[model samples]
Target: MELKSFKFDLDERQVKWIFSPLRDKIQVIELLMKIIKIILVDDKLDSERIKGKVVLRVSKMSRLFFFSEDKFFSINFPFLVFHANKDLSFQSKNGNKVDNKVTSDVLGLLASEVLLSSDHVLEFADPVADIEDYNSGFWSLLKELLLFEDGYIRYDYDDKHVNGQRHPLNHLDIFYCSGSTFKIGLRQRITDNHLMDLLDLETDSHFLERL
Candidate 1:
C-alpha cells in the first residue's frame, strides 16, 4: 500500500490564535489530529489503512485576528505539498469510490485562499440592524412586510410568473435603497470575486442574487 501526505506551513500568530485555541498546542502534530477528526469519521479508520497523514508546519511570518466577543481568532497560513499519492480513494456520499488523497489538501488551499481574499471585508459589523434602529419605525414596518431569515433580514424571491415578466430579476448591479443603504443584484454572470470586491468597499451592499 502506498502512503500519502499533505503538508502546509502555518503562520506563528495563526498557530497561537486559531490552532492553539482549537486545542492546547498549535504544533503540526496537534493540528493534524484535529483536522483528521474533522474530515474523517471514526469508522473509516483501520489499523493498516494505507498510512495517511496531514501535516501543518509553522512558518516565520503570520497574521492573527482576535474577536473578543466572538471568542475566536483567525490566522493566515501557507501550504506546501509534501507527498501526493495517487492510489488512495474514498467512498463518497453517493456510495461511489473517488480519489481522497487530495481532499485535505484541497480544503487547506480553499481556507487559505478565502482568508487571503476576504480579510479586508470581514472587519466591519452587520449594518442592517444598526440602520433600522435609526429609522425610528420604517424598518419595523419593512420587517413585517418583507421576508427574513430565522433571526436576520432575508428576501425570498419567487420565479412564478405566467408571462415570465413578474419574476424578481437578479443582476450584478448595486441597488441604492437609501442614502447610506444598498442592495446587491444577483444574476448568473456575477462571480464571487465581484461580490467580495463590492463588499470590501464598505458600502451597504446586500446580495439578492441567487445561484
Candidate 2:
C-alpha cells in the first residue's frame, strides 16, 4: 500500500507527537541533529539548547562542560573539553591520555543521565591548557562526535583512526546524520576580565529582583 507523506511544518512538537510510536529509536537521533543544525547557524535560538541548559539550572546543579575546535573538527562534552590546533588539524586531542567523550551517541552525550544527577559542578580553569587528561590522547567513544562543517558532513563509521594517527577522521556519516553544520568556534568560552564587562553577560540587579 502506498502511504501518504505527512507534512511537517518544521515544528518539533509536531514531529514528536506525530511519530511518537517510533520515537525511541529515532527521536534521539533527530533531536541531536536538530541541536547540531541550530548550533551551526545560531545555537542560542535552538530550544533544545536552551532546554538542555534549563535542565541544568533547574537541577540546581553545576555540571562541567567544555568544547574544542580545529580546522577539520569541533567537539565538546559534559565538562571534559579538549581541542586540537588548526595547524595540527590531523591530530586528535590528547589521543594518548584519555578519550573525553561521555557517551557513545551524540544525543546521549549532550543530554545524558549525568545531567539528571544534581551533584555536578563546573570544574577546572582553562583546563585544555594545563590539564593532563586534556593533553592525553583522545579516548572514550561515549562523548565522541566528529566535527562536520559545510554541507558535506558525513561519517563512515568505518574510518575511525587510532589515536595520534595521522589520517582524516571522518567516521561520522553526516549525510545520514540528518543535518548540516556551520562554522563552529570557541567564542562561548572567552573570559577576559577586560572583555567580560563589555559583554554585559548578566542582567542588572533590578532585572534579577523581578525574576
| Lowest lDDT block of 10, candidate 2 | 54-63
Which digits, one per residue and each the tens of the lDDT, describe model 1 over residues 1-211? 2222223233333334332323211232234323433333323344344232223222232112222211222222222222224222233222322223333322343245443355564421223344335434333332321222111111213244212333334322122123432333333343323432333323356544354
Q: What is the lDDT of residue 80 in candidate 1?
A: 21
- Please list the C-alpha lDDT of all candidates, in the order they appear: 0.30, 0.26
Q: Write the per-residue lDDT of candidate 2 for residues 43-118, one digit (tens) a residue.
A: 2334442211211100111111111111111111122222234111111233432211322233433454453343
Question: The CA-based lDDT of model 1 is what?
Answer: 0.30
Q: Any residue pairs clashing in model 1, and if so which?
A: 186-209
In model 1, which range of ten residues has the least summed lDDT?
147-156
- TM-score for model 1? 0.16
